[model samples]
Target: MSVQGTPDELVEILRETVVSLVRRDGPDLSARQLGVFLTVYLGEGPHTVRGLAEALNIGKPAITRALDRLEEFKLARRKINPADRRSVHVQRTTRGAALLREISVTMAEAANPQRTAGTPTGSQQGLKP
Candidate 1:
């Protein structure tokens, strides 16, 4: 049976999958925390505390709290920007990269429920164009 959905619907499914993965792997992280990490990780930055707050449209205090959570998990690191000792930059640690990788894999698998059906084996796995 072929499954069909609009782009938004598929995106919602993907979001749910990612949430589930996050809950399973790091229950301590809220969805907001994940969103903040992704935005910083993908943004053009120095990824400073202020930059993150501005990018996320949130208060600096809130960003700081989120950063604390990430640091507690050892998934991200914050270091003083050598260019300016007063500034700090946040970066994903090795553990963060590994977590992201595993979450992505889980999302891929969850996105396609058809896989459980045992048919059309291998790479072309019904990935619609």
Candidate 2:
């Protein structure tokens, strides 16, 4: 698929996004954890351990470990499926949904071309003209 925007612009967007997130004192999510969290929050569900594992190309144990951390942080939870005793479903917590909203807002602000001087730019605190 074709990607839009120059490498530098993309770099700037990501840089600012991270800075904005950090400024908010957000939780530190590992790459893998972020992937699973985003997938679960953004995708349609009744998500399961097995389904998340396969979708993320990760093993079930890894998903379990991530889920464990998510649970520890009160970001996500697992419930025993009522219809299938052998199955577990992952559900998003109120905090998790709130975090997703925070991330979405941060990303939008960082990417806004009209963002002011104080906004982070890859190497500096100002966006290039």
Candidate 3:
């Protein structure tokens, strides 16, 4: 089903998602790390460090650091491109996919009141029209 909501409704959904994420056990990811991770996971794969840096408009070193963190968390990994030994391809990990799925579930729960437990409806969620 297509997800449709106003800006305010989306904001409330995001707020609930964040709260749910906070309650879940995991290390807090920095904005940059999260950005890099999402870009790698959500976009076209077999991504290279240079391509990622370019896509993010960020420095290669910065992307490397983000990749390092993601690797530490078992989220993403890089491997040498067999075609071009000099370059590496960023690969998605099962752990990363699981985390992404969890986030998606959280977002879905927040959006669907029937699925959410004890969640307020409409303006009760403290969102202004």
Steric clash count of candidate 2 = 0
Greater-TM-score candidate between 1 and 3: 3
Candidate 3: stretches off by over 4 Å: 1-3, 115-129
Write the residue-wise lDDT of candidate 3 on 1-129 in tens digits: 476999877887987777776788984677788888889888987799999999999999999999999999999999999989999999999999998998888898788857765766546766554
Candidate 3 Cα lDDT to native: 0.85
TM-score per candidate? 0.73, 0.84, 0.81
The top-ranked prediction according to TM-score is 2
Off by over 4 Å in 1: 1-8, 15-19, 22-27, 116-129
Question: Model 1 Cα displacement at 63 (Å)?
Answer: 0.4
For model 2, give the 10-residue run with minimal summed lDDT.
120-129
lDDT digits (tens) for residues 33-81 of candidate 1 = 8877777666776698998988888999998888888888887889999
After superposition, which runs of candidate 2 have C-alpha atoms over 4 Å from their true positions? 1-4, 116-120, 125-129
Q: What is the C-alpha RMSD of each candidate to the true structure, in Å?
A: 7.7, 3.5, 3.1
lDDT of each: 0.74, 0.84, 0.85
Model 3 superposed RMSD (Cα)? 3.1
Q: Evaluated with lDDT, which candidate comes out highest?
A: 3
Q: In candidate 2, which residue pairs get closer than 3 Å at backbone N, Cα or C atoms, i.e. clash?
A: none
Candidate 2: residue 72 lDDT (0-100):
86
